[model samples]
Target: MKSNYFFRSIHAMRGLASFAVLISHSLTLYPFFEFRAAAAGVDIFFVISGIVMCLAIEEDTSKLDFIKKRIIRVVPLYWIATGLSVAYIYARYPHMSHSWDWIIRSFLFLPQQPGVDMPILYTGWSLNYEMFFYLILFLSLFIFKNAPIAAACIVAMIASFSAVGNLISYNYFFKQIFIEFSLGILIGYFLKFGGRVEKNLGIFLIFLALVIFFIHNKFASSGFLAWGVPSAMLILGAISFENSELFKRNFVKIFGDASYSLYLVHPLVIWGIEWYVLPEHRGILQVAIAIAISIFISIIFYKWVEKPLMRFLSKNL
Candidate 1:
């Protein structure tokens, strides 16, 4: 089946964002890389999740079915990665205490102690937020006639809470990060009904969004204020190019398809390099090799494991 160019653009951006996260962590070996802004990849992810949720879920789809499909999409690969992380931690630090509660919480997508965020897989921390947003979106389906209003309501609720200084007050629900999701929903609303801009105007909006991105980096520390809005604008701008030639590239679409695999599996790639490859060849060479190997392995893993499993589960579940 042919892929939608709009979604293809979104997915391609996802691949790029995932790569930014890989680079952000990998470049820690070189302090001169100066890519701290790449950490905003997570912000981009949250925005994408918010947007995709509103775009993908159908109006006729039941809430339970929606939740089940989300679980099928997210949980299986996550569990595999978490189990590997737990095993590695055990082998590496057998003397350290292993909290079953933490492991269970990680599996359940619950936040760890001190009311801060920690998951056994470490990167699974973002999955916690994803699951939280999914739950909210699922419930909203029961109460609202369409996904857009539900998304808008979510944004309004978070914005109001933020105004009252109650953001992040209700544990994880009212977090500042949720604002990104809200922004994404608003963008999704526009994409669903707002129609397209002229090609020149779209190009200008994209340029303006880039300017906002750099300005946010200069002035803002908060991810929501910094990268989130710019990320939303980028998505909006990218959608405007759905009918253009650039979005038709097959390589970009394939990279986007492998993005979820890259996101879930790159930590293992990093762990492998740190343990085996880095001690002997620890430099720019290793960084380059790590990136190449990570992407290669993620693509293979996606084709062999994630794609087949998701297809099976989608049919059976």
Candidate 2:
């Protein structure tokens, strides 16, 4: 398929989203620096997932093939990151108690006990929601051919889960957060078939998104209301402005391609910096340097490990 301006914008946004999360997580190293606002990165990711699913589904491909492709795209890199986390855990706390069941559940991305809902690699929690969304999307294809209808079903299911979330399993998929994914799917459908808006309106939406992002960071509202709405606004605005010159940059697109690698490997980079490189120096400058290194390393990983493995698997499997 030909790459459109919207897809290009989406690609660039992926890198921005990954960096946002990296900044937010850096708060762990420098608590004095307020980076909590960047946590909205996760919300951006959920929305992207929804939109990409709509864009990517091909009637020519079998549902099983689609599912397999999704798994191969995400799981291998995720497993490597999880392995790193496990090795770190073993080295850091040799006597730390860990359950075999939890480890299995972590590796499989299954929901475990509340306290340990996250995997050995805590970031894998997001992947659980991702996989769940993929499963639901895959199955929904059998029942609904229209992407919009399937998206609506996903929204309704998440809404129902949210209403009864307190009574049901506290798995990540059941949380209100999953609604972000549904919103993204709806947005995807809009991009595919929705009417065009005036460019001024697109600019307004972008401004609105920024305003909401800043406000949410300062006030700290519910994740869905705060980051979710802003993320949707950003995507909608970006789509609306897809034909603009702003979407034509190659650097952003390259970063977007490396976004997954950046997201997955960043934590390890942070860990190394914090635990070994400069344990005593977590000042803003150190954090900045660490973030720089993480980005550089992630680009390398993307260029080498991620790209090569994906190509190999796509060709062979």
Candidate 3:
């Protein structure tokens, strides 16, 4: 392992995690099965964001540049998706006035509801956490030059804000999900400094993740634990195979590259099916169709919309 060595595992896991989130929502929409573990995909994503932000900062990107790139990466497609969500909302509920609080706040990445409820385009809530995390990291860049130290400071900052945020917004922004990001930051630190684990250890980590996932699902609480620890374990395991080209498939790479699109667009596709094509139908067929359609459309959106926009923007920047 080397500091600058790119990990295919990161890309591969993005694909997997995005699919898991898609499946989780699909399941939620259809009510076909009980697979709360799929929700851990959000944890997986948080960890990935942590690692990405860490690596970006460590590579000597300016604080302003870091935030700029992050905004460019996240904001464009999100706004498009939000616009679509607004249309979906109005179409669904013609009674809702145009000056709704949730609509405005969703664009600003504020909480759409009082406590723990997601925004329109439901999966967009995760982006709120992501934007805040980037802000924290951007601020940290002014103080701690060390990536790991800055990451640690981010954890503390999140904890501090979470403690105070509970009084007013009751937002998840200051909650246990940061643990996954911290875990990823620690992992990113280790890898950045040339850390590696044995294959057997990687396997063990995944096994342990499963155990923890089951235990958490069955008994453990949210906040401090929930899915954070296990998702970290799973990611740590995946990256262990980074040097082996295990995640190097073209198909896999596309999924990873297109993950953001997959995440934002799938909810629309799924609910669209529920609203028109598969209304009141509770079956796995709808789930399959939703996933397939989501993946297909996301790839197209990535290639045509997201990739081109980012390229043009980055080139100009």
Highest TM-score scorer: 2
lDDT of 2 by residue, 85-147 (tens): 888878877998968888888889898877765788877888888888888887777877674
Consecutive 10-residue window with the lowest summed lDDT within model 1: 1-10
For model 1, which pairs clash?
Answer: 168-174
- Residues 1-317 of candidate 1 have per-residue lDDT tens digits of 11341466677779878888888777754444566667777888888887777677666777788889899999999998889888888987899998898899898998787654678777888888788788878878877887656765775586456555643545555556677887887676666665565667767777987887777656646646667777777776776676666666877776788888888888877776777764545788777766888889989989999999999999987
Whole-model lDDT, candidate 1? 0.76
How many steric clashes between backbone atoms does each model show? 1, 0, 0
lDDT of 2 at 277: 54
Number of the predicted model whose lDDT against the real structure is largest: 3
TM-score of 1: 0.89
Worst 10 residues of 2 by lDDT: 1-10
* Shift in Å, residue 197, candidate 1: 3.0
TM-score of each candidate structure, all chains considered together = 0.89, 0.92, 0.91
- Preferred candidate (TM-score higher): 2 or 3: 2
Candidates in order have lDDT scores of 0.76, 0.79, 0.80
Ranked by TM-score, the better of candidates 1 and 3 is: 3
**Model 2: how far residue 140 lies from native, Å:** 1.3
